[model samples]
Target: MSIYRTIGIIGAMAEELELLHRHAQMESETVKAGLVFYRGTLHGMNIIAVKSGVGKVNAAVCTQALIDLGAECILFTGVAGAVDSSLTIGDIVVSTACVQHDMDVTALGFAPGAIPYQEISVFPADEELRSLAVRASRDAVNGRVLEGVVLSGDQFIASRDKVQSLRDVFQGACAEMEGAAVAQVAHMNGIPYVVIRSMSDQADGSAHMNFAEFTVLAAGQSYAVIEGMVRSLQQA
Candidate 1:
């Protein structure tokens, strides 16, 4: 019997999943049963990919489902709005940690971005995977590859003020819809995971106007780096 290595991918938008799936062959039975699952190869490693809708709750649910089916590592791959001006569109961000910037408990005296009601300071990315992601980012970046924290929440950030607030409180470089939640779920289940995202826009007034034109291309660039990382893992 072949030793199976299961890797889960959570694509935030429909285009992300569609672009990823396009990289796989459409053979019947390749997809795993009873889950919105698909199977394919990356650097000769078997992969199971799934779309995790959008938002924290949806991402959590999909992550648990992947864990239940024996995914050893889950990757949240998609696009994010850059909080750091140094990062431009198409720059890949491989997070060292993630924060739910929207999580607030000020009355309880916990600082925003604190793991609510817990002593843990922040959620860490799997170091081994992070290393590989860095390598992959280096290979794929058109502009630059930045490693930092990515803030997660339901809303798509399209304001300079909100983006500035996130940067101020979390020191996050990018903002996405699902990464932190996926990391939290993976942590709970003892599964290792990481987030790899490409900057789609600066989270400013221009973001909303530019989103439609850039989202797919940004997601494709993200998928390319993620694919490289998965391939590297297979080789090792």
Candidate 2:
């Protein structure tokens, strides 16, 4: 059993942030990088949580700030558009790893998702954290839980063709706006990380409408899994 002294959580939207605020008993809050951070305890484990807006750059900045504030591990939670056809609204997709789907240097002979001068553009999550997350997901989500690659980019995906292309290139389970950025920052900083995303919509023509309707349900699933993960870590 192992527990990090302090864990940081980054949620992408109001729905996700609200669930976090309700779950953790924050004692004090501070503003850093134009983001408000709440410090408290979640199921007896120290927590610093924030809403990092909804982009790769924003996520990167907030992750570094959390690291500076003494977060031993970083967790990114939110809703995503499903890339895998099997996933439906309310299903959870815990990342085994994540990739920046928009990073392209194919002209320079680098892979579509690869970054120059880096060993790999696909950043892996901490194994133990992943295991805990998967277990917690199984318990917390009523819908199916899957562990697979999560693709992240700045654009909100709302096209079936785009989804098919991403799945073909990256083999991702889901696509979102922030997870891989957080993964990259956490990896570079030598901190353990995990990304737990709930599927709010299929990445199809009707994605926006579905997301609007189901984001709260998806966010709730994510919060439950994250809460379970924290409780299990505290017990461990």
Candidate 3:
């Protein structure tokens, strides 16, 4: 008896999504936008899950597709590079809002991270959903659970300089390729959305190595949080 009728979930990679797929009672599969969307039931709530691949356009396409398929809410989950200095690998970040860190319009004085012409550039997460996610995350993860902005870009953050830039510009807890785009779509569609990221790397010189070693662990943390959220919603 969740308040939301159906939840759409988008994961950024195979490892990010593989475990959850096994848990959901998949009823049907649809292939669209080069992504396989699994329609199913999880924790007594209707869910449509998909691996959104990577990057902004792919994530945006995945979100809209889920909406078209009747998802009332969107949940985007995956691992990301930590941008905040306080964050460590394995920390979980539940986005209060999302921003495209790469969306620069500085020349036109639109300010960094602003999507020109849009009423709001930094898309917001649903307040109710955000609270639910935060509560669930604390219960689900052994690591630190944080509430902050999620920064998205088409690039894999590896440089320390770039990480500092993002930290100064957006104050994001995590930086990834897809979450903000998903947020943008959900915002435009007037659908409630939440983006969850578990830190796999520090977005520094050793990021790639760290990401390779910790992505699965980080993804597991994120999945647990998602499960916790679904259970909370169902019981509510």
Candidate 4:
């Protein structure tokens, strides 16, 4: 209803959304609500940021809804557990591509990690947006920016052994519950999108033990990176 241009942002949890919303409010125009959309003007650009709840289905549904509401680009921002040894809590992972780690189709004659009914095993991110995210993460914090594949699954991977297995198999940088699904939705709709996640915990050894303690700092760093990306996108 207002100006028409829109960028969709999907936050996987309430805390994540709260951070994004707080940043949005600091912009000049307050967000306006529609039947299924929350519209705001940030740096003179229209944005619709929504909490996609959790899991793959929820993320996909919310993404589709945003696209239907006229979003041209979708950005999935939130926290993830680190899969790579080089990463640490609070580091940013800017995805080069995403895959569903939980997907298994070998029994049905499809390869493991491939989406059912889909030919491609990997879904790539929008290059331009990925570049912007990398720069933003570097600018936002002294945190290192890891540009690698992201693996998404239904499980919350806090197990070191399990995380190591996944890392060995997929060589993924981070593990989250929603990135691949969000990417799939965007790909299907022919819309541009990118997944940006901050490391909330190490996927190995003490991941489970330290998750509670690391979440606050992880989410805060994640918010700053995403906020910087939003601002960068506006400049672009």
Q: Each candidate: what lDDT?
A: 0.80, 0.90, 0.89, 0.80
Superposition error at 176 for model 2 (Å): 0.3
Tens-digit lDDT track of model 3 for 89-169: 888898999999999999998999988888899888999889988888888778898899999999999999999999888
Best by lDDT: 2
lDDT of 2 by residue, 90-192 (tens): 8888899999999989999998999999986899999999999999999997889999999999999999899999988989999999999999999998999
**Deviation in Å, model 2, residue 103 alpha carbon:** 0.6
Which clashing pairs does model 2 show?
A: none
Question: TM-score, each model?
Answer: 0.91, 0.97, 0.97, 0.89
**Candidate 4 residue spans exceeding 4 A from truth:** 1-4, 25-36
Candidate 2 off by > 4 Å: none
Task: Evaluate candidate 3 by giving its C-alpha RMSD to the native, one decimal.
Answer: 1.0
Total clashing pairs for each candidate: 0, 0, 0, 0
Better of 1 and 2 by lDDT: 2
| Tens-digit lDDT string for candidate 1 (59-172) | 888888878766788888888999987998878889899888888888788888777656664679999889988898788766788899989988989988998888777889
lDDT of 2: 0.90
Which TM-score value belongs to model 2? 0.97
**lDDT measured at residue 33 in model 1 versus the true structure, 0 to 100:** 32
Model 2, backbone clash pairs (residues 3+ apart or across chains), number: 0
Q: Which stretches of candidate 3 lie over 4 Å from their true place?
A: none
